[model samples]
Target: MLNAKWKKMLVGSTVGAMLVVGAAGAAFAADAASPAKSEKHAAKHQAKLEQKAAAQGLTVQQLLDRQAARKAALEEKAKAAGLTMEQYKAQRQAEHQAKLEQAAAAKGLTVEQLKAQHKERHDKVVEQAKAAGLTVQQWKDRKKAEHEAKLEAKAQKKGITVEQLKAQLAAKKAAK
Candidate 1:
């Protein structure tokens, strides 16, 4: 009963509608797949946490409580800022990147160069720690103690208290 022009229009509309539906179905399928991926990732993270807790001689519940407390603190901060957690995290990440860029500029390096330099230093430290049969944290603690001893010695040589020396150093840093 339709004319040739009407038939063409009907066919075109049907094809367009089918294409839209197909696209929607594909998007829905992708959204559905994301949850499975997230679930797997979450399970792996939980297992890692349990392993870490066992290594540290802490109960899994204790470790989880610590994590939950940290998360609650972050959530409260986000709420105070009138932002969702994701938005607050994104804002903080952007600020961190800006600080990195500023530091790199001050050091006459590109951001990538600064990052690479940091990674190189970190890798060297990790290698040294492994060679010395010390964990990274243990190595860092030893270095910190040595540095504090040197600072204390310097303070004594200058006839200044440690707190006064620290305040002077902080003032110099702020001046810079």
Candidate 2:
């Protein structure tokens, strides 16, 4: 009876330790996978923010400060332009509409009609993807692959990456 009880206790303790070790291994593997994913995500987000800052010719903090200051400056800019804020907004919208109208006319459609067509096409694509068991990200990945292929083909033709092509163009413009 004493030997049986000792054997039982040993078995129970071994099983418990194995369970804890198994759980720890699984948790470690999960943690390992996520840091790589999160690091990639963080890198992409940082690149995007940097691009936005560069486009504005400002540092990231300055870009944020500029956006914060824009609210107070909007009225001043509009006033300087000899229009009230509402008038300025309407004028800007009219200019945008005119550009859109010109673009739509080139494609043989009115702007409103063209937008409806675009909405219908977008909806159809979404519905078809759902029917085909594709998530939005899957569709986006396919589109990205297609775009990258085109870019690669173009780069091959030009014998350069897109960045190299842009640099060549800039050099040409500067020479001119």
Winning model by TM-score: 1
Candidate 2 stretches greater than 4 Å from native? 1-77, 121-158, 163-176
Query: How does each model score on TM-score?
Result: 0.62, 0.36
* Candidate 2 least-lDDT 10 residues: 132-141
RMSD of 1: 7.0
CA lDDT of every candidate: 0.93, 0.83
Supply the global lDDT for candidate 1: 0.93
Report the error of model 1 at residue 158, Å: 2.3
Residue-by-residue lDDT tens digits, candidate 2, 78-105: 9999999899889989999999899899
Clashing pairs in 1: none
Instruction: Write one digit per residue (lDDT tens) for candidate 1, span 1-176.
Output: 99999999999999999999999999999999999999999999889998778644567899899889999999999999999999999999999999999999999999999999999999998898878777676788889999999989999999999899999999999998
- Cα displacement (angstroms), candidate 2, residue 128, comes to 9.2
N/CA/C clash count, model 2: 0
